[model samples]
Target: MIRDALLFQLGYNATLVTLGAMLLGMAAGVGGTFLFLRKRALVSDAISHATLPGVGLAFMVMVAFGGDGRNLIGLLGGAAVSAALGLLGVAWLASRTRLAEDAAIGAVLSVFFGFGVVLLTMIQTMSAGQQAGLEGFLLGSTAGMLRSDAMIIAGAAALTLGLVLALRRPLTLAAFDPGFAASTGLNVARTDLAMMGLVLAVTVVGLKIVGLILIVALLIIPPVTARFWTERTDHVVVLSGVFGGGAAYLGAAFSAALPDLPTGPIIVLVGFAIFAVSLLLAPQRGVLSAVLRHRMFQRRVHLRQGLLALAQGQPIYEPLTLRLLRREGLALPDGVATPAGRARAGKALLDETRWQLVRQDPSFEAAAAHYDGLTPIETVLTVDQLDEIDQRLPQPHEVSRP
Candidate 1:
C-alpha cells in the first residue's frame, strides 16, 4: 500500500502526477525566495488570486469556439497573462499612487478575485461548462491530471530553476539593496520584473495541482520555514526548495493513499507543520534556542560583574550575583574569591577594560581581539590597576544612561 501510494510501484499515472507536484513545489520555492526577500510575499497571493478569471475566461472561450475547454495550454496561458497584469498593476499602484504596497496588493487581490468569481459564475451558465471542470482550478483536483499536463508543469519548473541559477548574483544584490545594484550598472528593475515573471510561471503551473487559492502557501510557507534555520540567503533558498519538494512529495503520497483527500490543502498543512517545528526547535533562530541563548548571556554577564566586584574587595554575596559567582567556580562558600577566582576576576576586569577602550577608540584592533575570544586568559590586572580602571570605567547601569 505504501509503495503504491508513494509511486514506487511504477503506476504510470500516479508517478507522473507525483513528479509534477514535486517539480511545481520546487519551482515555487525557488521563485518565492526572491519574493520573500524583496518583502513582496503578498504579491504572490494577489497574482494567484488574479489568475482565476483568466482560467474561467479561457474555458468559456474554448467552449464557444467548439474546442475542448479543458485544454491545459490554453488555460495556463490565460492564467499567465492575467497574473502578469495583476502583478504589474500592483507595482504601478505602489509607484504612481499614494497607496502603499500592502494596500495595493490587497486592493488588487480582492478586485481580481471578485471579478474571477463573476466570470466563473457566468461560465457555469454556458451549455458545455458543466463538463469543463473549471472549478478544479479554484480548489485543485490532482487526480484528474494527465501525463501531458504533468509534462507542462515539469518544463515550467525546469525553466524557472534554470533562470534563477543563471541570475542568482544579480537577483540577490537587487533584492538586498536595489540602489547599490543599480549603481553597479545592473538593471534592478529588469531583474525584478524577471523575478515576477518567474513567480507568474510558478503560479500558473501550480494552478492544476494546488489550485489558485492555496498556491501562495506553497510559495510563502517553505521559504519562511527555511529562514528559521539559516542566516545566509543562498542557504535559505536551497533549504526552501528542499522543504517545498518534501512537502509536495509527502502530500501527494498521502493524498494518493486516501482517495477522498485533496492534494493542495494537504500539502499546505504539511508545510505548516514543518514551519511550526522549525519555529520552535531550530538551533540558531528558533524561539527555544533564542531564549536559552539569552539566559546564558545574562548568566555570563552576571558572573563577570560579580568577579569584578570581588576583585574590588566589594561584597559579592548579593543573591543573584553570589549564585552566578558560585556557578562559575569564582566564589568559595565563604563568599570570597578563591585564588583561581581572583585570577579569573583580574582577567575579566582586564578584558572589560580593553573592551571599553576599543569602544572609545574604534581603531584599537588589539583591544577588539580580546573580545573576539582570541586573547589568552593569562592576561590579568593587579588589584591597584583594576581599582584605577574601575574609577574611569562606566558602571553597567550608568552605561545605559543618557
Candidate 2:
C-alpha cells in the first residue's frame, strides 16, 4: 500500500495531487513562521475565513458574465483580494479604532465568513450555480483538482519559497525586533506587508488542497512543532517546512488510498500527530525530558547535601546518607564511602561553595553566641547566625587561588 501510494501506482492523478499538497505545505510552513514570530497567527485565520466570500462572489460573477462558474483562476483571484482586504480591515480596526488586535481579527473573521455563507446561499439559488462545485472551497476536495490546478499551485508555491529565501535576513530582523530593525533604516511596515503577501499567496494556493478552514493549521502546527526541537530561527524554518511537507505527502497518500477521506483534515491530523510526539519525546524541551532532568537535579541535590553533612562532620541519618551514596555510585555494597566516594564528596563540597550554599571557614564561635543550648553547629545556627556566616564568608573572587 505504501509503495503504491508513493510510487504513483495508485494513479497519476493521486501522485500529482500529493506533490501539489507537499508544495502547498512547504510554502505555508515557511510563510507561517513570520506570522508566528509577529504574534499575528490569528491574522492568517482571519484571512482564510475572509477568502470564502471572494470565492462565492467570484463564482457568482463568472456565472453573471456567462463564463464557467468554476473557473479556478477567477475564484482564487477573488480569494486573494478578499483575504488582503480582510487583513487591511483588521489592521485598520486595530490602529484606528479602540478594538484590540484579537477583537479586530475575530470581528473580521466572523463577519467575513458569515457574509461568505450568505453569498454561497445566494449562488446556490441561482440557475447557473447548480454545477459550480463551489462547496469544495469550503471543506476542500482534491478529487476535482486538475493538472492545470496543480501547476498553478506549484507556481504559487515556488514564488512564495523564492520570496522567503530572498527576504530571510530582512524578515528575521523585522520579526524579532522591528524597533531595532527600524532604527537600522529597515522599513518594518513594508517588510511586514511583503511577508503578509507571501502568506496570502500560500493561503490562496492551499485553499484547493486543505481548504481555507484547515489551511491555517498548515501555517501553525508545523512551525510550533519544529520550535520544540531547535532554538535557531533558520533551523526552525527548515524543520517546519520538512514537517509540513511530510504531513501533506503522507496525508494525501492516505486519503488517496482510502478514497473516502478528506485530504485536508487528514493532513491536519498528521501534523498534529507529529506535534504530539515532539511534545512528549523531543530532547531538552519535551515533557518527558524536562521531567527526567528535574528528577535528576533533585537526586543530585540530595546527594550533595548528604556529602556536605559528612564534610562538615555533622551527624547524618545513616540510612539517608547510605541511600545518597548508593545513588551517586560512591558507596560499595558495604554502604561505606571509598576513596573515590571521598573524592566525589570533596567535589560536591566545592560545588556547594561555588553555589554559595555553604560558607567557607565558618566561625562556630561567632555562630554559637546566638544559641543558648549545647547543640551541634549546624543545628544550633539560627537564621541570623546563618545570615552572618553568609556575610562573613569570603567572596567568590576573594577566595585564595589554587
Candidate 3:
C-alpha cells in the first residue's frame, strides 16, 4: 500500500491530494526562509492563528448570503484578509507603540484566535453548520478531498514558490544587511512586506492540507533543518524546499497507506524526523562531526605533549598520552622513547627553542604576537628572519645533551 501510494497509483483523488501537499510544503519552506533569517518566525504563528477568525466569519457570511459555507476559495480569501489585518496590526504595534514585536505577536495571535474559537462555537450551534466540517481547517483533513480542490492547492503553492524565487536576490540582500540594502537602493520596507506577503500566501494556501497550527511547522522546520547542512543562504533555501517537499510527499503517502492517520500531524512528524537526522549527521555542523573533530584535536594535543616529554627525558605519567605514543610507535610499553621518537623529540625541542628565541627578540615582535603554541615557527617567520634568529643561537657544543 505504501509503495503504491509513493508511486502515485493510489487512485486519482489521492494522487492529486499528495501532489498538492508536496507543493504546499515546498512553498511554505522556501517562503519561510526569509522570515527565519529575519528572526520573525513568531510572526508566522501569529498570522496562522489570526486566520481562524476570518474563516469563521467567512463561513458565517456565506451562510447568511445563501452560498456554500464550505467554499475553499472563499474561505481561503477570507483567511488571507484576516491574516493581512493581523500582520498589519502587529507591525503597527511594534513600530508605533511601546510593545515589542513578540508582545505584539502574542497580543494579535491570542485575540484573533480567541475570537475565532468563539465564532466556531457559534457556528456549531447553527443549523447549516452541523455538517460544515469547518473544524478540519485547524488541523487539516484531506480525507475525501476532491480533484478540483487538490489542483487549486497545488497551483497556488507553485505560484507562491515562483514568487519567492523571483525575489530571492533582493530578499537575500535585505536579510543579511538591511542597512546596506537600503543604501544600495533596495526599499527595505517593501522587501519586508514582500516577505510577509509570501509568508501570508503560504499560510493561507496551506490551510486545507497542513492546517493553520501545523503550517508553522511546515514553514519553520525545513529551514532550520537545512541550516544544519549549509552556511550559504541560497543553499539553505534550496535544501529547505527539497526537505519540505520530500517530507510532505512521504507524509501524505504514509497517511494514505495507513488507515485512521491524519495528514497534518503526519507531515509535521516527518519534518521533525528530517530535522533530527540533519542535526545528528550533517557533515560540517552536525553533533557527530563536532565530536570527531574534538577527538582529532585531542589526539594531536596528546601526541605533541608526549613528544615534548620524550625530548625533555621526563617520565610519561599520563596513561592516554603514553598509549598514544606507543600506538604511533614513538614509545615502548615501558615508557622508553624509541629511536624515531628521539628524532621527533629533537625537532620538537628545536622548534620550541626557536619559538622562545623569536618571542624574546625585539625585532620579531610582530611575528611573536601571533604565537599560539601549536603553530609551527617556520610559518610565522620568513627564511631571512629565521636565519637572523638562528645567528643569535649558541654553538652546537654549548647545547645541553639529554
| TM-score to true structure, per model | 0.87, 0.84, 0.89
Arrange candidates, best lDDT first: 3, 1, 2
- CA lDDT of 293 in candidate 2? 84
TM-score of candidate 3 versus the correct structure, residues matched by position: 0.89
Q: Which ten contiguous residues of candidate 2 have the minimum total lDDT?
A: 368-377
TM-score of predicted model 1? 0.87
| Every candidate's lDDT | 0.83, 0.82, 0.92
* Candidate maximizing TM-score: 3
Please list the residue runs of candidate 3 whose C-alpha ends up more than 4 Å from where it truly belongs after superposition: 128-130, 314-316, 349-402
lDDT of 1 by residue, 141-216 (tens): 7776788988888888878878886788988999999999999999988998898888888889999888899999
Residue 366 miss distance in model 2 (angstroms): 34
**Per-residue lDDT for 365 in model 1?**
53
State each candidate's clash count. Answer: 0, 0, 0
For candidate 3, the lDDT comes to 0.92
Between the candidate structures 1 and 3, which one is better when assessed by TM-score? 3
Query: Candidate 1: lDDT over CA atoms?
Result: 0.83
Per-residue lDDT, model 2, residue 46, is 91
Error of 3 at 346 (Å): 3.1
